[model samples]
Each structure stands twice: as C-alpha cells, then as structure tokens.
Target chain A: MDKLLLLGDEALAQGALDAGLSGAYGYPGTPSTEIFEYVQHSKEAARRNVHRTWSANEKTAMEEALGMSYTGKRALVTMKHVGLNVAADPFMNSGITGANGGLIVAVADDPSMHSSQNEQDSRHYGRFALVPVFEPSNQQEAYNMTFDAFALSEKYKTPVIMRLVTRLSHSRAGIVRTKYLNENEIKLPDNPNQFMLLPAFARVKYKNLIEKQELLEKESENSKYNEYHDGKDRSLGIITCGLGYNYVKENHVESKCEYPILKICQYPLPRKLIQKIIDECDEILVVEDGMPVIEEWLRGYLDNCLKIKGRMDGTLPRCGELDPAKLRTALGLEPYPIKEVPTIVKGRPPELCKGCPHRDTYYALNEAMKEYGPGHVFSDIGCYTLGFLPPFNAINSCVDMGASISMAVGAADAGLFPSIAVIGDSTFGHSGMTPLLDAVNSKANIVAFILDNGIVAMTGMQDSAVTGRVEDICMGIGVEKEHIHVINPLKGHHEENVKIIKNEINYNGVSVIIPRRPCIHIAAKLRKQK
Target chain B: MKKNIILAGVGGQGILSIATIIGYAVVKVDIYLKQAEAHGMSQRGGAVESHLRISDKEIHSDLVPHGRSDMIISLEPMESLRYFPYLKPDGWLITNITPFVNIPNYPEMKHLLKEIKAHKNSIAIDGDAIAKEIGSPRSMNMVILGASAPFLGIPFNMLEDSIRAVFGRKGEDIVQKNLDALNRGRDFAEEYIKK
Candidate 1:
C-alpha cells in the first residue's frame, strides 16, 4: 500500500479517484475547495480526462453531478455547508430520482463558523432527504469511507452524503490508499422512468425512498465506521459523533478509559448500538459538532427515562467546535490552568489586503454615497463582503449569495432613494443574473456595482464563470445597455469612479457600474507563473 | 514522546511552509505528525495559526489543547503572543521581532517587546534581518524555523535536510540560500541563549 500525506479533503479526492470517479463538480469554498483542487491538479485525473472544474454555483454543480451519475458514472460533488442550501433544490429532489451509478455529495461543515456565515450541520439535510450519510472521524477514515460510500450508494440506489467538519477537512495526515476500481461504462438506467419525476412517478419514487429508511438504519447499525466499546464504568456511557470522537480519544490516550463509549461515524441514529449503550450505562452523553440533531432525537423522539446530556443542556457549550479542553470540563475534570493572552495583544480581525481593488471601489462608493448616508448598500459574499467593516462602512446587508441585487431592488420598491447593490463577478454569475432580470422587469431605480476582480478571488482565485462577460450578461438579462458602465478600480481613477457612481445613483432606472481589476493575489500568481 | 507546536503568523507569511518542512522531516523519520491549517477567507491578510503535532503514537485531535503546547513558533511578534493560552508555562516562544501592522490599533512596539520578555522561555530574534543578511529576504520563514528547531525535539541537521528537500524544486540557488538563512538563525539563537 502506497502512503500519501494528504489533507482530509485531499484524502477524499484520492478516495474518489480510486473509487473510479468519472466526474467531480464543485463551486469553490473553504475546506471543501481543496477536494476539487486536488482532483484538478492530479496527473492521474488529467490522464483519465475526468470532468473536474468549477461550477457557477453549488446548484449547478449538484445538477451536473447528477447528470454524470445518470450516465452510469460515479460522480462526487463538494461544497461548504451553506453551499448545500444553494444546492438543496436538486439535492432534495435527487433522493426520489435515485442514483443510476454512484453519486457522492461531500459537504464540509464549519462547526465554529471558521470561514463561514453559519455553522450548519449537513447531517440534518441527509436525514431530511432520506439519504444515507457517512461521517468520517479522521483522515484515513475520510479516505476509506469515501471509497466505500460509492459502493454503498450504488447498493441502495441512493446518493450518499459524506459530511465533513472544518477540522477534518483542513488537517493533514498520512493515508494508505486502497485498490483502484474501474470506472463504469456508459450504461443508462435499466428502467427508462427511473429518473422521470412526473407527479405520478414522483409519488412512487417518494414511497420507495420512504421504504428505504429502515434498511438505511440497519446498514448504519452494521457499518464498520460505527463501533461500540464496553468499559467497566457503567455509571457513564459516552457516545461521540464524527470529529467529536477524536477529542474523547485525545483525553483517553494518556490513561485507561473507564466509561463505555459508542463511536458513530454513520447516520440514521444506529438505534441498535445506541439502545445497547443506554441499557448498560446510567446516563449517556451525546457528543456532536454543529447542531444537536442526534441529541434532540434522543430527548424529543425517544423520550428515554435515563438522563441524556449534551448541547441542549449546559453540559456542553451550545455552539462552536469541541476540543479536548471542552471535553475535559464535560467529563468532570478541571480545566487546564492556562495563561491568558496579555492586554497588550490586541484583536487582529481579518481585513482586506492593502492593494485590494475592493478598497478603491469602497473609497469611491463611500464618497459617492456621502449624501445617501449608510444603510443604502447591500453586498454579496466575496472579498467585497469585508465592506461592512470599519474605515469604509459601505455595505449594510449580506444575507446570502446574490442577495444584494434583489435586496437593493426591494429597498428601492420601499421608496428608499439611491438603493445600491455591491456584488462580485463570480457571485453575479452564481445567482445575481436572475435578480437583475427581476429588477429590469420592474424597472427598479437602483445602482448595482459589480466588482469584477477577473477571478473568484475569495477562495484561492478559482476561474470565474463570468470572465470577460459581466456587461454582456447584464445586457442579456435586459438591463439597459446605455446605463451599464465599466470603470477601472484604482486609486488614481478614484475621483472619476466616484463621479460615475454618483451619476448612476441619480438615474431613475436600473443601472449597473462595474469596477473591474485583477485581484492582487491573482495578479501576483500570474506574474510568478510568467 | 509527544510534542505540540503552534505555528503563528499572518495568512501570507509562509507559516505553513514551516509546517511543511517539519512535516517532511517527521515523515522520513517514520513518526506521526498532524498539521491543521487555516485556509480560504482568513488568507486575505488576516491572522492565522497552524497547529502542528508530532508524536511516536497516534494524534487524536487536529487542535493543540490549551496549556499543553510545547512550543509556539511565530513569524511576527504580536502573532506570537496570540496563542498564550495554548502554550505551557515553561514552553518556548521563538518568534521574529518584526510587526505586521495590518490592523488600525496595533500595540506599541515597546509594550509588545515587554510582553514577549515576560514569558518564561522566549527568543525574540530579528528573522527579517538575518534573512536579509543571508541574501534571501523571502527566507525569513526558514530563519524562524531554524530558531525554533533547537527546541523542536527534531535534529538541527534533519531540519537542514528538510529545507533542501522542500526547496529542491525551486532551484539549487533557493536551497542554498534557505540553508544559509537557517544556519544564521541557529547561530543567532545559540548566541542569544548563552545570556
């Protein structure tokens, strides 16, 4: 067996490759981004001509992967937790349609909101969609489970969700790879209507999905990733889920553990093993990252007599990633005496780079909107989202991807004059086009600033889907041609850029201003490569 | 034996490169190592730290537990102090003396230096100056790595070999320059500790 030092995300990529992955689709995001990156950079993937590229957004990625699966090929889709929300449409529907070949959805969740707006657990989505979910506890498991997930997917005719937390996705460890499987030949589904979802067909598919739940649970109970260990200490039974298992092992590695432990890395509750733990011990501690989905089920659904302690109670902090220190306090041990950071150590929040084009754009936008005051600009996710911070308190709202354009339209309809929207080029391609059409249809009086950095810019400069086509897309969406203006965002052109923005703000109809420049990081990368 | 180390710096400060060299060294020695890195959004000129753990046995967690770290190797002075809770009372803090003042209200240099000196075992070396003196300004991270190598439980020569292995692809010039920077940093630390 050959060993490779790989990040958890990279391990998953290798697992997919070894599992005969035919296509890999994903939009760039933290933690999950490297999975696709590894695939794209692999010589093996290149030799195989595997379909690995960035999608416009997670929804497109999801559907594209489903398309590949329909062709009787194994496909993997990667995204962050919030990206799951964007892909939820096709994702939820895919449960009923079922997978033809193997389909694996790998979502990296941020339990502490490390680089995300929210720390959502995608495990709930797995349950909601009636799909089997696999949670790997460590790097090697991430590899093994992903390779196994494909086989599991085809066995059940369902898309398998592989849930990963930030820590698991970002950490590096040596992994021993398994034997490579052959890619599936082009063979369509035996039944022509397997993917057809007309109301009549959908109803039967839905029922089939409903009937599979019991089997999924049984599979979970028998999963290799889930194990039950008996200890002499019957007073307490510890149940750890996903990455939380590591912290418990961290605490126990030094000494012999007295409490019985049930480690769960697969979904569907594994009630058989859980029940055994409950019957043997006095109380059960449900350790999990993100939301207390399992804990809530134990208390609300089972309503067992024994005490179930977890995030719902104060036993563990309600939020954030769990570490060994937190586990120490939970197990009735005193916290380690640690030196606090001195007063001289000031807070160092993440900031925009010194030469970021968004800086020039913000400076000009702030000057142009001096009369309109604050609370007028709505921004989308990107490096530009930092506009909410000080020195340039430019943007007011940042709810979701492509929310800026529609939000600004809504504000304009509410009689707020000079309603403005700031979005990035990549984001505009993702979900902004539809909202721009909505504004164009209604002729809303607003100024939309498209910050075109010629790259995705935020997630390590992935190629933007809307490269050299921002204005063309806006025009194609029915935004007036004359009202669309492109300005180069630079300190030297700040005054003219401000003038252009002010002119657009005064326009009664929907207007778009693009501040175009290469991202600093992208420019440097290009220079270095040259 | 187990060793927990926190590698701290700004996002673009080549902190992960230090982790890479050490990782390569440990892998060759057939020891287990786990490095948890910060990526994506934080890389836009924000503070970042990589938790590097090396041991003979398995490492369970990606994070270094608070007050259990054996060393904090940092590229910036203030960034060095950011992980105080993670460092043991007697742990070493080897960091560059320069400041990366990306924030608006960075602390005064004197106060920052005073806080560094308050630590039980600390080395505030001029990594930037030594790198420049070695004629490789970009090798400042290598210098910081060299300064911390004495306390890393890894052999100095192993780290020197790692520098060559990690930088070999760039060119022989880069390898030699980085090697020079590492030795200079070690020389500085050997002299500074005599006091």
Candidate 2:
C-alpha cells in the first residue's frame, strides 16, 4: 500500500473517490472547501466524468446530492458548519424521505470560530436529524470512515453526517490508500414514493426513521471505529470523542493511560460501552471538541449518580478548540512557563489585498456616501467583507449571505433614504438572487452593488456562477435596464464609479451597480500561467 | 528524537513549501509528523505560522506548547520575533533579515535587527540577497530553509533530496536553482556559526 500525505479534507475526498463517488456538490468555505476541490482536480474523477462543481449554495448542493442519491448513485455534499444552516431545510427533511443510494454530508466545523462567524457544533444537528454521525480521529480514520460511511448510509437508507473540526480538517498526516471501488450502476428507488413527503407519506417515513435508531445504536456499539480499552488503574475513566481521542493518546505514549478508556468516532452515544466506563471507574472525564453534547448526555437531566468532569466543570476551558496543552492542564500537570510575545510584535489582522478591486470600490463608496453617514451600507460575505476593516470601514453590516440586499430593502422601507447593499458576485448567486427578486417585486428603494470579481476570490478562486451574467440577472429579476450599471473598479475610473454609485443611490426603485474587475491574485496567477 | 518547529512568515510567502520539504523527509524516514497550519483569511498577507511536530515516537498535539518549541524558522525578522514566547529558553531562532514592508507601521530595520540580536540565541541572514545572487530570487524560501537546515536535527542531505522530490514536477532547472539556493544559505549559516 502506498502512503500519501494528506489533509483531513483531502483524505475524505480521496476516500470518496476510491469509494466510487458519482458526484460531489458544495459551496466554497474554509476547512470544507478542499473536499470538492480535490475531486475537481483528481485525474480519476475527471476520467470517470464525476459531477464535481460548485453549487449556488449549500442548500442547492444538498438538494442536488439527494437527487443523485435518488438515482442510486453515491453522492457527497460538503460545507462549513454555518453552511449546514443554509442547507438545514433539505438536510432535516431528508431523514423523513430517506436515501435511495448512499448520501454522505461532510460538515467541517470551526470549534474556535477560526474563519467563521460562530462555532456551533454539527453533532447536535446529527442528533436532530436522527442520523448516524462518524467523526474521525486522524487522517487515516478520516479516509477509512468516509469509505465506510457510504455503506452505512446505504444500509440504513439515511444520509450519514461526517463531522470534522478546523484542526482535523486543515492538519496534515500520512494515510495509506485503500483498493479502489467502482462506481455504482444507476438504478431507481425501490419504492416510488420513498422520496415523496406528503403529510401522510411523511408520517409513515418519519415513523420508519424513528424505528431505525435502535439498529443504528447497535451498529455504533459494534463499530470498529468505536472501541473500549481497559487499564489497571480504575481511578479515572476517560471517554474521548473523535479528535479528542488523538489528544488523549498523544498524552499517554509509552503504554496508554492507566484508566478505562472508551474512544468514540461513530455517534448516537454507544451507550453500552459508555455504561461500562461509568460503572467501573471512580470518576469519569469526557473530552470532546465543540459543545459537550456527549458530556451533557452522560450526566443526564437529574440522574447525577456518577461524577462527570469536562467543559461544564471548568476542568477544560468552556470555549475554543482543544489541544495537548489544555489537555495536560486538565489532567493536573503543571504547564511549562513560556515567554510572552513582546509588545513590539504588533497584531497583523487580515486586510484587503493591495490593488484589490474591492478596495477601490469601497474607497469610492466611502467618498460617495460621506453625506449619508456610516449606518446605511450593508454587506455580505467574501473577500470584500474586509472592507469593514481599516481605511475603508465602508460596510455597516455583514450578517450572512444575501442578507445585505434584504436588510437594506427593509431599512429603506423604514425611511432611510439611499439605503445600499454591497455583495460579491459568488454570493449574489448563492442567496442574493431571491432577495433581489423580492426587492424588485415590492419596488423597494435600494441600490445593490454586486462586487463582480469574476471568481470566488475568497476561497482560493473557485468559479463563480455569476461570472458574466450579473447585469442580465438583474434585468431578469425586473430591475430597470437603465438602472443596472457596471463600472470598472480601478483608480483610473474612481470619479466615474463614484458618480454611478450616487446615481443608483438616488434611484426611486431597486437599482444595481456592479463594480467589475478580476481579482488581483487570480489575475496574476492567470498571467503567470499564460 | 523529537523536533518541534515553528515556521513563521507573512502570508503568501511560501512558508508551507519549506514545511512540505521537511515533512517529506520526515515521512521518508518513518517518523511521526503533525502540522497545524493557519489557513483561510490569514493567507492574504496576514501573519501566518505553522506548528510542525516531528518525533520518533507518536506525537500528541497538533500545536507546540508555549515555551517548548525547539526552533523558530522565520521568513521575516518581525514574524520571527512574533513567536518569541514559543521558543524554548535555549532554542534557536533562525530568520531571514529581509523586511516585508506591506504595512505602514513597520518598525525601522536597524531597530528591528537590534531587538532580534538582543536574544541569547538568534541568527539573521540576508536570504533574499543570497537567493538573488544564486539567480533564483523566488527561492528565498529555500534559502531560509537551508540556513536553518543545520539545526533541524535531520541530516542536511535528506533535506536536499526532499527538495528535489518536492520540486521535481517543475523540471530540472527549478530543481537545480533551489538546490543551489539551499547550499548557498547553508554555507552562509555554517560560516556565521564559526564567527
């Protein structure tokens, strides 16, 4: 077997490819973005003509994957934790519909909010959807679990959720490749209405889903990924989940910890093994990333019969990602005294790239809106979100994808004249379109600036769905043709761009201004390639 | 044997390339390796660091505990000092003297150098100048890697071989230029140690 060094995201991608993935759909996001990228760049994937492309957003990606699964093909959909929120509608409902082939939803969580708005755990979502979840401890396990997750999905006829944190998703390690499996032949669902969720059908499907929980727990208890190890000392029982197991094992290198240990990678609690640990040891410590879902459950509502220690007990810090240093302190070991970073080393926060088109656009917007004051411009996510920092300080609000346009419209309805929305090309396609339609239909007074930078510049330059179609899309949504203005965002065109923005601001109905240019980084890479 | 290294530099400066070469060498020798990298927004000219842990035995954490790192290999002077607390009391700090002046408030070069020299164990080399002299200005990262190679615990030749393997896809010219850059940097460090 050949070993290849891979990030956890790449390992999952490779695993899916080797496990006969027919299609992969996703939106570009930190930690989870690389899964689809690896498949898109894989020679094997291209040879197999696998459906690998960026979807409009996570919801569309989830629905597309479900469609593929309905055709009896294995499909993988990935997104960051917050992205799951966008896809939650289809994701939660998919449980009632059940899967036709195999469906795996790989959601990479940011426990410490690294490159994220929040650190909401995805494990809770797994429990909410009544789905079995697999959380790998290392790169090898990430690969192996992904390979097995499809079979688990097909067996239970439910989408399997594979949860990963920032550390696991971005960290690299060596993993051995497994024998490749061929693509599944296309077939239809056994029952015609398996996917139909009319209230009557949904009731029966929901009941069937409820009944599968027992078997899911049984499979989890017998899973090779979940194990119980006995130790000579019965003082402390250690229950580790996912990457928590790695940190624990890292501490006890020579002969493993002298405590009864249960390592859980497959979820739905694995009660019997956990009961064994609780029954044997004098005290129990639960180590898990994100929320203490397992820890809270083990304690139960009022049955505090045994002592349980974890995040809730201040044994570990309540927030942030876990590491060896924190674990050492939790185990009562004195930490080594490290020197402090000198005050001279100033903070270097991320900023807009020099010569970035967004900088110019923000500069012009800042100049144009000086009279209206600072509270009017609403923004969406992307590299342009950095406009809120430094000299620009241009955007007033940035609260999720597509919210800018709708929020600006609502503000305008409340008599804030010249209300403006600044959004990115990729984001405009994601959730921006529907909101724009709503504004147009209601005839809301708002000037929506679509920062059209050709590529999805923030997440390593993936293709944007609205590359050359921004203006046409505005027109299709019933915005007046004359009010849809495209201006080059550059120093040479500064005055002209500012004037255009001002003109749209004064427009009585929904207007759009597109500040268009290629992202400097992507442009340079293209120039070098040529 | 255990080696805990902090690879520091401004984002988009190819710090990961140096880590990749060393990681390849570590893997070829059957050593355990774990690297925690700063990704996403930080890659856009923000401060970036990679905590790389290598050991003959299994390693526990992806992060290097504060004050326990064996070496700080930096691509810029200020970025090197940024991880000052992580460097063990007697640990080495090898950095490129070049200043990446992307920000307006960058400290004066003379004052920065003096602050760096105040450390008990530190080496500052003009890696950009050496890379340019060797006709591979883009290989400044390789030069910094070479200057710190002697203190890496791994055999120097192993790094050279790893460099070749990592860059082999780009053809022979690139491979040779990087090799020369590495040698030039290592030679400079060897002489500085003697002095």
Candidate 3:
C-alpha cells in the first residue's frame, strides 16, 4: 500500500471509502467540512459513484444518512460540534431505530473555541442516545477506528459516532491504505419493526438499548483503540482519553512515561480496566480533552475514596484545548524555558476580505439602524458573525445557525421596535426558512436582511443550498410579495441599498430585504474556472 | 534528523504552499512528518501559523512545543515576530521583509525590521522585491520558500523538484518563473549571510 500524506479528516474519509462506504453526507462545518470535501474530490469515490452531495442543514443531512443506512449500504454523516445540536433530534432517535447498514456520525469538536462557539464533547451526546462512541487519539487511529467502527456498528445493529477534536481533524500525517472492501448490496431491515418508533415499539427498542449497555462496556474493554500500558511508578495511574493520550505522550517524547497508563479512545468507561488501574496506583489522574467527562464519571461511579485528579481538581485546566505544555505542568515535569512574545506584536484579528459584500451590507445596516440605536440587529453564524467585531458592531446576537430570524421574531413579538435579522444566504437555507415562516404566520413586525453572497463564503465556499433560491424560498414560505426586496450591495449602490433597508424596517410586517452579491472569493474562483 | 519548524504568515498569503513543498520534500526522503494547521475563522486575513515536524523516528506530538522549534520561516515581518517565542534560543529566523499591512496598529516598519534583525541568527530578505525583479510578483511565496530552504535540512534539489512537482500542472512557463523566483531568493539570502 502506498503511504499518502493526509489530514486527519482525509484519513477518516479514505478509511470510510476503503471500508465500503456507499454514501457520505454532511453540512459544511470547520474541522468537519474537509471530510466531505475529500470524498467529493477523490477519484476513487467519484469512480465508484458514491452518493456524495452537501446537505442543506445538519438535520436534513442526518436523515439522508439514516435513509442510506436503511437500505443496508454503509453511510457516514459528518458535522462539527455545534452542527450536532442542529442534528440532535434525528441523532437521538437513530439509536432507537438502529442501523441495518453501518452508520457512523463523524463529529469534529473544536476545543478551546478554535473555530467554534463552544467546546461541547459529542461523547455526552453518544451516551445520551445510548450509542457507542469512538474517539481517536492520532491520525492513524482516526483511520483505523473509523474502518472498524463500521463493522462494530453493523455487529450490534446500532449507529456509532466517531469523535475527533479540532487539532486532530486539521492536523496532517501519513496514512497507510487498507484493503478495499466492496460496498454493501442494497439490503433492507430483517425485522419489520426495526425502524418503527411508535409508542409500543419505542418502549421495546429503548429496553433493548438499555440491556446492551453492559455488552457495549465489554466491547470497549476489548477494543484495540483502548489499551493499558504498565508503568514502573505506582504513585499515579494516568488515564488518557482520545487526544489526551497525545498530549501526555508529548511530555515523554524522548523516554517512556513511568506512570501506569490507561489510554482510552473508545466509550462506556471500560470498567474492568479502570478497576485494574485504580487498584494498582495511589491516585488517578484523568487527562481527557474537552470537558472532564471521564474524571466526572470516575468520581461518581466509584465510591472508593480514591483521590481523582484532572480538570475537576485543577490538575489541568477546566476548559479549552489540552496541549503538550498543559500536560507538562500536571505531570510535574520541568517546564521548557520559553521566551515571551515581544510587546510590539499587535493583535491582528480575522476580518472581512477587502471586497466582501458583507462589509457593504454591514456598513449600510449600521447606517440605517443608527437612529434606531444599537442591539436590535440579531445575526447568525457565518462570515457575517464578524459584524459583531470592531469597526462594524452591527450585529447583536450569534447564538446558533438560524437563530437570527427566530430571535428577531420573538423580540419583535415582545415589542422591540425595528427588529431586524441579519443572516447569510446559506444560513437562511439551513434553519432560517422555518423561522421566516413563523414571522409570516404571526404577522410579526420585523425585517430580515438575508445577505445573499452567492455561496457559503465561510468554511471555504461550499455550495449554498439557497444560492439563487433565497427569494423563492421566502415566497414559498408565505412572505408578502411587496415586502420582499433584493438589492445589490456595493459601494456604488450604498445609498440605494440603505434606502431599501430603511423602507423595509418601517414596513413592520415581515419584510425581507436581500443584499445580493457574489462573495469576493467565489467571484475569483468563477473567473479562474472560466 | 528531527526538525520542528513554525511557518507563519497572514491567511491567503500562501504560507501553506511553503509548508506543502517542504512536506513533499520530507516525504521524498521517506521520513516521518506531521503538520498542524489553523483553519476556518482564522483564515480570514487573521494571523495564521502552521506547525511542521519532520523526523527520522516515530513522531508523537502533532504540535511543536514552546522553545523547541528548530526554525521559524515566515512570509510577513510582523507575523514572523508573532511566533518568535516558539523559536529556540539558537534557532534560525528567516522572514520576508515585506509588510502585509492589514491592521490599523501594524508596528512601524523600521521598528519591525529592527526586532527581526536584532535576533542573533536571522535573515530578513525583501522577497516581494526579489520576485518583482524576477518579473513574477505572484511568486513571492516561492521566494520566501527558497530563502528558508537552506535551514530546512533537505537537499536543494528535493525542494526544487518539489516546486516542479507542485507547479508542474500549471505549465512550463509558470514553472520556470517560480524556479527563477526560488534561485533569486536563495541568492539574496546567501549574499546577506556573507555580509
């Protein structure tokens, strides 16, 4: 097998393809976006005619993956940590329905908020739904475990989640190719009620889920992803989970670590192994990235007054991503003498590109809403979220994917005058359409500015679901004909656009003023393609 | 041999191209290599960095630890200063003298130049000027790559081959311009070190 240098995301994508993946689904999300992109660009996937298409939203993506799994063809659905929240409803129920085919939800969590709003560990979601979760410590394991996760999912007829963090997802390493397995033939569920979730059937499925927990625990104990390395030191037994193993190993790069180590990259706690390590060592230091999930569990599960250490006991930080330096301090290793960055280094925050349409849109909105005062323009997740930053503090809120329109609807219902929502064209297609329908149904007094930049400019310009369909989606959602307006967002059209924005805000009953312009990068891309 | 190098530049400045070329060169020698990158939100003209590790033995950490990096290669002057703490006390700092002045509070150029020059082992070459002289201003990244190529511990021909392999698809004219850019940059660095 030829060794190819690939990012961790690419490794997982290649692993899935080699393991007989029939379809790959995901909405574009940082750290997770590249997974789908790799499959889309792969010659082998293209040759095999794998179902590789970007979904409109996370929820829609999750359902389509489930549908593929229903046909007994292996499917992999991917998303970032926050995107999981959008897909939570379908994700929670997939556990009950189970999988006829191998189903793996590849979730990349951003710890330390590198490119995310929060560092939510998806393992909690895995545990909540009573499904198996696999967290890979390195790129090779990211590949190896993803390949194994499919068979594991099909073995128990359950959906499995393979979780990796920001560092691992974006990091690059060499991956050895595995044998290519043929894609599964289309085969439906054996049992008739396998997918039926009516009250009576749901109760039975829920019971089965509960009964499988012990077996899952045993599977974790035997999982090659989870290992126990005996160390000479008995004073401390270190429990390193997923990326934590890398951080801990970073400290012992030259020599082997002395502490007894339990490296866990799989779920269900692996009770027997935990017991063995705890019995041998004086105190247990649980070093897992993201939240102190393992530490919290070990503390509550074991009543044995064992001194537990981790983010909980301040051995490591409570939040943010873990790195080699953080582990060095906790391991009581001597710190590397470091030079402090010179004071002359100024902060250079990420900003809108020079010719970005969002800049012109924010400039006009800031002007139009000047008399209405600040804190009324509710915005959502996108490049437009940067409007909250300096020089263009036009947006107020950035809670989730499509919360801008809905939050504006709620605030306007509570009598906030001149309520406005600032959402990107791609975001509107994701979760903004339903909330827009709510505005139309309630006759809410609000103006939603759908900044149509022709594509999903953020996350490296993926195809936007509503690129040219923004106006039609609003029309279908019952938006008034006169209330909808589309205008160019440019320096030359600034006055005309501002007038349209002001008029819409005054119209009061659900007006959508769209500032339509192709993103600067996309325009450049089109020219190159041409 | 082991090398932990931090490549720093503004997003869209093509620091990744430099990393990619080096990545290919390291792979040519059949060595273990890992690169950690900052993507998504940070790429919007933000201060961006990449950690690249190449070793003969098995590599553990994807990230380079503080004060352990063997060299710092940057395409921007201020960006080169931004990651100075990552450079070892005896490490080399090879950076472009060009200023990508995107921020309002960009330090005074003379002061920034002084900070980079004050480093015991450093090379600040005007890569943009060299690329322009070579009649290919767009090849400035390759110029920076060439100037830092000596410190990379890879054979010169390997990087030249890497440049050819990476840019070969673009056509022979573009390839020749880049090769010229690389040679011009390496020439400038060699002359500066002698002074």
Off by over 4 Å in 2: A254-256, A301-306, A525-530, B108-111
Tens digit of per-residue lDDT, candidate 1, span B1-195: 789999999989899999999988887777888999999888877889999999999899989999999999999999999999999999999999989898878999999899999997999999998888878999999999888877888988899898888999999999999999888888878888887
Q: What is the lDDT of candidate 2?
A: 0.90
Model 2: which residue pairs collide? A250-B60
The digit string of per-residue lDDT tens for model 2 on A314-370 reads 999888888877887887766767767766777777888888999999989999999
For each candidate in the order shown, give its overall lDDT on alpha carbons. Answer: 0.91, 0.90, 0.90
Q: Candidate 1 on A279-307: residue-level lDDT in tens?
A: 99998898997788888878886566658
Cα TM-score per model:
0.98, 0.97, 0.98
Write one digit per residue (lDDT tens) for candidate 3, span B6-28: 99999899988888888887776
Off by over 4 Å in 3: A301-306, A527-530
Listed in order, the DockQ scores are 0.81, 0.67, 0.77
Most accurate candidate by DockQ: 1
lDDT of 3 by residue, A1-530 (tens): 87888899999999999999999999999989989999999999999999898999999999999999999999999999889999999999999999989999999999999888889999899999999999988788888887789998998999999998988999888888877899999999999889999999999999999998998999999989889999999999999888889878888987789999999988877999999999999999999889888888888855456588999878999999888888989999888877677788899999999988999999998999889899898999999899898889888899999999999999999999989999998899999999999999999999999999888877998998887788888999999889899988899999988898888888869999999888998887778889
